[model samples]
Target: MARSARPVVHYMATRPDGTVPPTCNHLARYYSGLGETIPTVNLADHIGETVDHPSPGEKWYTDKPFSYFHMYTRPGEILERLEVEERWPVRLWEVEPLGETGNWGNDFAPYWLMSHQIRVVREVEAWRAFGHRGMQVLATLAQLPDLARQWTEEWTADPEGTRRTYTAWEKRVDHTRALTGWAFCRAQYSRREAGLQAANELAGNAAAQAATAAGADPHAVALIQLRARCLVAGQLMFDRIRTGEYEQSIRGLLLGAGLETPAPALA
Candidate 1:
């Protein structure tokens, strides 16, 4: 059977003249080279399309908003311009400079988050909506009140085997894979610290009052507490999708998962 075609996305960057920039042209060429089709349409011609009555192109872009960055100018440049114009009074450089290299503050965090956990979450939601088992693990997490008990049984039955399984699972949900130093900006870090504290408190409460009541192993109970922390961190991340504080949510998740620091800053 033939594979289903991926959706096509259309976008262009406008220069001061309202004409396509070299960057936009470069993207069209790159996508064409890869056997992808990106249609060109003028905003003037597409004015008839509104949020309520979107064209096919608009709908596609809405579903895949990252398409804008995939073929657009550097985010640092965009934000810098906004700062210069005083239209975007938010000075990101005050928190961290937009380094030129493969740096943290540039655009890496957003791309990483989109390509990793955020993408996984959306895929899981889509699968669940369609009544598919592709996202069964997450669904199981939602339904299982005493994940600690379940994990304890598995671990007691197969010590090495359970360690390997949970370790691998932990890596897949590793928040550091999608976060960066941007998440540790002073104010954002404070919020992340608070989220982590809440998770710890919840886990401790569960362990103290409900561990034996639920008949869960101590180690497994710890893991379940970590998972609860992960949930809080994930929610925080989803809340700041388009803000400077975005990375902190991922950071919080990492901390909740017992990670010491962000994953070595991507070398």
Candidate 2:
């Protein structure tokens, strides 16, 4: 019998920086020097749009969305294979994992990508895991426009009352694109919250019972778990900062939006 394809993980390869992102050799070849132009037509392509006749070259088409299809190896499989091969062995659970080619020297691609802007497509349940942390997922959408402006001057060239000029058309197009991303982000954000809440309640109850059985203070036990979680998460953020992925991602986002070069980080 034929085997089904491995589940793909999705991520935005374009960083806020204009330079090529450091990733696996395969994905690097796929998206190097790539620029994503603001999509003109909606994905459905059924809805009609106002036309301002922008040049074709002005709109760049990137295959970043499609590149996920080519990815086949998962973190577990990559780690197992690498360990057996005795090349760049890494603890699957300890090291951050990103989806990438299962080759030596590129072992760090997945972790770096995950730290910067990678998203796993499979293991849909993982969203629940993040929710327990009480993370504000909606903030990414909330910050898009500000990110755009920080990246590009042309992002705000046209006000609502501006005539049907090229600049105005571009602004309108960007607004629509931003709205689409916002909608998707909002849905995921809601799902993550609901999932996190449910998962935490279940775990908290279990922890409380276990603690009570051991004649321990259940409340104190729960508090300790929460404290430990915060510390671990904070450490991960610190690691991202130290590795420069945090700054690189911010720059990549700015570039992807076609706003301008060298966007400033939010203080």
Write candidate 1's Cα lDDT for 1-267 as tens digits.
Answer: 999986432122222322212213455557678887654322233222321111122211323212222221222222111112221222111011111212124444321111100000010111111111214323433433564455455556665555555455466455345332332232142333322233334444543344445655666566555555454334334444334554554545443433322232223
* C-alpha lDDT of candidate 1 relative to the true structure: 0.34
TM-score of each: 0.29, 0.19
Q: How much lDDT does each candidate structure score? A: 0.34, 0.28
Q: Which stretches of candidate 1 lie over 4 Å from their true place?
A: 1-145, 153-159, 170-196, 207-216, 241-267
Local error of candidate 1 at 264, Å?
26
Residue 5 displacement (Å), model 1: 45
Model 1 Cα shift for residue 15 (angstroms): 56
Model 1 lowest lDDT segment of ten:
115-124
